[model samples]
Target: MYRFRPRVLVDVSNIDMSTSMLGYPISAPIMIAPTAMHKLAHPKGEIATAKAAAACNTIMIVSFMSTCTIEEVASSCNAVRFLQIYVYKRRDVTAQIVKRAEKAGFKAIVLTVDVPRLGRREADIKNKMISPQLKNFEGLVSTEVRPNEGSGVEAFASSAFDASLSWKDIEWLRSITKLPILVKGLLTREDALKAVEAGVDGIVVSNHGARQLDYSPATITVLEEVVHAVKGRIPVLLDGGVRRGTDVFKALALGAQAVLIGRPIVYGLAAKGEDGVKKVIDMLKNEFEITMALSGCPTIDDVTRNHVRTENERIKSML
Candidate 1:
């Protein structure tokens, strides 16, 4: 017989995880990251996730490559929606998406700028995984619209990214939508400042979930530099490896106005459905509030530099 040691309780006393994005107040600092196929995860896909976000009073960014069309998802969601757009071979095809998103009442257009070409996905490649062809584009293309010939999702993605697009294209995107514009895939302080100078409304400090560049720095690593570079000229948001409440707390402490969630939400969607997605969002909010409280943060402001010691410790260890 052995004596049991008493467990030490962690203190999470006063926490405030409430935050906002693009002038919309959200219950927490989390947004669903846009992934291409929702149908593969669940039958309802974007529609289910949108409903889930609405139920939790959170925001969600719908993908351009979503299984359902913009109107379909927008009709089901009470949550604020942002459209994530990628460049297509033709300007008209890209413009059509923006117009449709605007007509469907999306509040902003997030132009993803890093993928001029699709990066190889080994898991998808190995399994010979094929994304289901979108019903929406069935009659829109030519007589022979090839779907699975290239590789997998990567091949499909390669067909969409426009290498010809430049800063001029960004200006054109701004001209097309009355909604605010946010440039995603910005990884450097210089590019962040350039976006501000380009007259965009916000910058999302992302690396396309580390799917694009294999050796790229994590979104959290360069967040401070981007935030400080922007100097409050525009709101800065982050995404990638942010699954915990402490992750959200750390982001705010590092100066991100809010954070975006990607793969975890997809995982939840895969496991359950709309309900699973909602549960994931709620779990994040609850954890964020708890982390804030335990860290002695009563409000968003209370999660300051002093509250994040691990980051500092890591930096010191690097030196």
Candidate 2:
């Protein structure tokens, strides 16, 4: 679906894919994206995912709805962790989570700016999917109760999540914690520029995996626009549909500092728990390394926008 401009006869005998996020060094630029209810995927849940991140030497944005507690995941391993959160109607609860993440040694707070309300997922509607008992909110919010009618997840999120969340609320989020704030879910350059203006540390170009709205542009398609807007002011990351090393390569060529993987992580966890997750990460890392070598890139910085050519560009060039 995409073409890479590989330069031959350039020595890439020792390719390096190592990079850092918010000053935290990682073995590779690949990170584990937050997906709710990892427990449903594996018995170990976020703990297992955290361990995989440790083994792979990368970051994992633990979901706010993780089955395992923050302290439990933190003590499980020395993996670099960040917490992904949605603003709750109860601002106190959101503030409490920020405090807990900091206390538990999380390196950053990834504020997912989308999902003001749950999207209408048809599969969930058909299955009446019951979300796992959210352990983190056990005492803080009632999770034992499940709606007998429709999707319990939709009901719970509607009642708990702050639908009124807006760009101005970034200031309120900043007031709560000192951790670096990376706003996720920007699909436009305007919003990316606004995020930079708001003083957020980084931006993640995403559309909540395109489940939030119909006909939304893919995150990768809009990555260059967002990156062009930011103009290297901060790191730009992408997460969604990244299944291989080439996907990571294409993203980097488009200006993504790194990419976070979502479904692949859960797939691995569902298959073999911690080891499965590691296999997924290792596969991507190895693939990315090979891709870099073939492309004459010896390091992360060597990956540039010119390295890739999208189909649209190809057609235009022919014309």
TM-score, per-candidate, Cα-based: 0.89, 0.97
lDDT of 2 by residue, 39-59 (tens): 899999999999999999999
Q: Which residue ranges in model 2 land beyond 4 Å of their true spot?
A: 315-319
Cα TM-score of candidate 1: 0.89
Clashing pairs in 2: none
Candidate 2 lDDT score at position 88: 94
Candidate 2 CA-lDDT value: 0.91
Worst 10 residues of 1 by lDDT: 1-10
